[model samples]
Structure formats: structure tokens, C-alpha cells
Target: MPHTLAYIPTPAPATPFAVGETVEVLDREHVVLSVQTIKKVTRKKVKTDCGREWMLDGEWFDGESSYPFPSIRRKA
Candidate 1:
């Protein structure tokens, strides 16, 4: 079954995620990366963009820093 999400308003400049979008949570302190599937979690996590699901254990911020993924990169 598909997962349902909640609504949340994560402020702009922080909102970079979209529903059904894939993201990577960055672990700055430990230099580790965690991939996350984003879905609207709650109204608080909501933005013009969608929230996340399948979040890996790492550090992520919605409004301050860019989401990071180390293992994966855009093809050139």
C-alpha cells in the first residue's frame, strides 16, 4: 500500500524537497550519508515542497542547508 503523509510548513530557503522525491541526509559530524525517500510527513514538515519518508539515521535540516548524498551523484 502507498504511505500517507501529514502537512507541515517548513519555511522557504529551507524547503527543497518535493513529494516522491529522493533525498540524502548528510551526517556532517561523522561524514556519513543517508538516503531518504521524501513525503509530506506532517503539516509542520510541509512546504511548497513535499516531505520525506524512509529517512536514514543522519542529520538533515529543511531550511538551513542543502541536502547531501555522497555515494550518489548526477551523471555527466
Candidate 2:
């Protein structure tokens, strides 16, 4: 049987994020991590810019399918 993957949305930005980009989920402090893209965007919605705004329903290395970071501060 073929394998199937579930979908989940990360509470981060939805538009400016890129594959293989390291970002910091900003809150009280900077929490840095790396991200890898697994699928293409299916749909999108413009939401608030508070913290979790740029991410979408996708897959990551954390064994979860979605943007996990709430608010990322991209590492430079």
C-alpha cells in the first residue's frame, strides 16, 4: 500500500517563508531552528501579523505536518 501523510498548519508567516531557511520562533526570546519544505502550497489566507502569521499547512522535520514555529526571526 502507498503511504500517505497528514497535514498541519504552522503558526508562523504564510508568505515570506522559504525552504531550508533557519528561523527563530520569536516570543519572549529567540528560539532558533531549521526548517525543510516537504510539499507545495495548496491554499492561503492573509491573517494577522501578531506572531503566527507566515506559516501554512505543510511538513517539517519534527515529525509533524505543518509550520511549527509560531513567530520566526530568520537567522542571518
Candidate 3:
């Protein structure tokens, strides 16, 4: 038997962010945390102007593929 890593995509939808792009951070209740531009972006990290970061390739998930802290969204 072979081992296969399962990654069932989270039901929550989050917008992937890029460097120099503005985004809004929201709490579990969808309350805004902060609105700022991305300082740095990578598969392991996404740093914001406010010094907040989330590590994930697709939106807001950590190395463990779990969503930690605030979620993100495009600036309106």
C-alpha cells in the first residue's frame, strides 16, 4: 500500500494576495482587522504593512494547511 496525502480544500473562500497589492484582513466574524498593502509574498509567507503574515499558497493557510489568525480579501 502507498501513502497519499489528502488535502480536502477548505469550504472557506479566500482571495490569494500579491506583493504591492492592498488587501483587507477579517476576523472569524468577518470583521475587518486591517487594510494594507502586502509587503512581501511567498508560498511560506505573506507579510503585510501592519506586520501580519499568513503562510500558504492558496489564500490563508499555514504550512499545516490550516487557516490561522485573520483571513484576507481584496480591497473594495
Model 1 residue 34 lDDT score: 47
Q: Write the per-residue lDDT of candidate 1 for residues 1-76, one digit (tens) a residue.
A: 9964432222233343445555533332323244455546443342213243222221243455534322221111
Per-residue lDDT of candidate 2, residues 1-76 (tens digit): 9954532333444545454455544432234343322223224421222223343432222323334434344455
Runs with alpha carbons beyond 4 Å of true place in candidate 3: 1-15, 57-68
Which clashing pairs does model 3 show?
A: none
Better of 1 and 3 by lDDT: 3
Q: Model 1: how far is 61 from its true place, Å? A: 6.8
Give the top-scoring candidate (TM-score): 3
Candidate 1 Cα deviation (angstroms), residue 4: 41
Query: Arrange candidates by TM-score, highest first: which order?
Result: 3, 1, 2
Error of 3 at 23 (Å): 0.6
**Candidate 3 structure quality by residue, lDDT tens digits, 2-54:** 96553333223255567898777776555677788888887667877877566
lDDT of all predictions: 0.35, 0.37, 0.63
- In order of appearance, the predictions have TM-scores of 0.33, 0.29, 0.58
lDDT (0-100) at residue 4 of candidate 1?
A: 46
